[model samples]
Target: METIVFPFSSKFLWAKYLLVFALFISAKALIKLPINGTIPAVIVFGDSIVDAGNNNDLNTVIRCDFLPYGQDFAGGVPTGRFCNGKVPSDLIAEELGIKDIVPAYLDPTLKTQDLLTGVTFASGGTGYDPLTPKLASVISLGEQLNYFKEYIRKLKAIAGEEKTNFILAKSMFLVVAGSDDIANTYFVLRARKLQYDVPAYTDLMVNSAAEFVKELYGLGARKIGVFSTPPIGCVPSQRTLGGGIERECAEDYNVAAILFNKKLSSVLNSFKTSMPDGRFVYIDVYNPLLGLIQNPQKNGFEVVDNGCCGTGNIEVAILCNKLSPSTCTDVSKYIFWDSYHPTEKAYRALVTLILQNIIGDFF
Candidate 1:
């Protein structure tokens, strides 16, 4: 039997008016939300901080495709995430109501709808420095941009030139990199240190970043959000490497991050004038991340010093495998999921701050 459902008969004018009023209220609420308008897509670039498992397919040891990495993700299946769950990029997409999940650009299972929404091109351990990508065997920012160009061609074929142009112009582009440049290039190997001092090296990074932003602007990216480098000195891996046996935050590395962020913010500020039609806003992660590390309890974290995987001091990527008995049982209590990446809870908290900061420039 067919069941007819209705609050009132169509003949009841009051019921119809009440329904329309409710819809109007709901629409107003949606307009006040972060994403007041529909975005065509969200193009991503940068390193592991925003990588949505692009490294899984790459032939490199700098990967997190095994167990203990995505233990907190849906169904507990590892998906090459450096953390126990979603990263900042994923959270940002959710906040914008674009898509609850942001698939990797390289994901073989990606559908046409996924392309219509957004995808990530970020790879673990990549940076502005050319050698940084080489060292990790991951996609570099330059190569990522090349892929973006390819995507544009493919999208144009599907959506046509006019619609594709409109989509690309209306979409948001996010950049979060440079941590590996400092950690892997300068500190770990000390290769560039011989040729350039700390200040000079930072200048090189800022120059590369600026060039990338300008290139993106030229490619019709009107709304761009460039992420500031987080405090590298405070991460568990850096702490173990540079901190004393007690494991303290390395002040020198943090200073480099601070200097880079200062220069980056100022440079992006100039973009407002140089590219009047474009909106280039610097998203700050340093202060919030530092606060999380300094006062873990304030943010509902119990373990701020170490990660949840392995010993939490040195283990990361494959090192924090399921085979490792030292991996923590409770990822929720930890601020970091591994040596360099934060836990999902912490990432959610930090990404909210990032969203708040970009809401004005973005929506």
Candidate 2:
């Protein structure tokens, strides 16, 4: 059995928080990164998009710890990432020149240096809604937070209290979730449809997302970026299930995502205004991804509605395997690697576009 740690009991951790608060109160009303400050690490949370193999060891069917998943990765060995290769977490870290890859916190083979830098706690098939992970038997966001706390302790052991505190304060935090909640739990499963309508369900998601961000702040994360839900209706799997005859984007799903994104952006803006000591940025991945799906050729992608794997209609997770007929010969020409996730090439393109715009937001 494994022991799970909760609560920030260390006096050193509390002292670090108090000291930073005092500095903010006396020196400035808002917190600002020092001119020479550098982001020491890239910490991540949320679902499949940023999950760096966190679900590999978990007792869940929602895993891709086998062939064809990491075919584009180094040595073509599947490291359990839910894509053809590196996901956004790895791309962001690589872009920042921090490291080539961001390891998962739950990975047993994680080295000390990996912890000292950063790691992801994201799991595939998870969402902001509590029930989403339950349906898939995956790690919940709350459990991911617990793992993060455990990670902090290990980081302290490796680098000592002072360096640990600095890394927590200076690190770049990324949150990418909500797609599964809308696509799987609410719409496809019809789990929350009876309890709440579209607007109300979106409210539940935004509230949960806001609460999660606050908890991260309580844990010493200062610069955090939360990605808005993509146009889930346009993803191949959703199109197959909901797009009727023509196999177009599912309008209802896109509407729900738009509702959530609007509220999420507003809430993040409010956080920026209220929590002056923290940098809260809402990253809009919706429009960028939507553009890719609508105009594939502009980005050198031939297929946008379907994924590069198999028939690309509904294959994902266990459904997407090497046993499938075949994968596309040229993954770069397709925006998505599976029914749910983008290809490494597409992720790299999106990360490049995002970094060009938001890199200055953190420091």
Instruction: Give the best candidate by lDDT.
Output: 2
lDDT of 2 by residue, 244-362 (tens): 98889999999999999999999998997788889888898999999888777888989888898899999999888998776788888899999989999889878888777776777
Q: What TM-score would each prediction reach against the true structure?
A: 0.90, 0.90
Question: Weakest 10 consecutive residues, lDDT, candidate 1?
Answer: 1-10
Off-target runs (Cα >4 Å) in candidate 1 are 1-36
Clashing pairs in 2: none
Alpha-carbon RMSD, each predicted model: 7.3, 6.4
Q: In candidate 2, where is summed lDDT lowest over 10 consecutive residues?
A: 24-33
Cα lDDT, all candidates: 0.81, 0.87
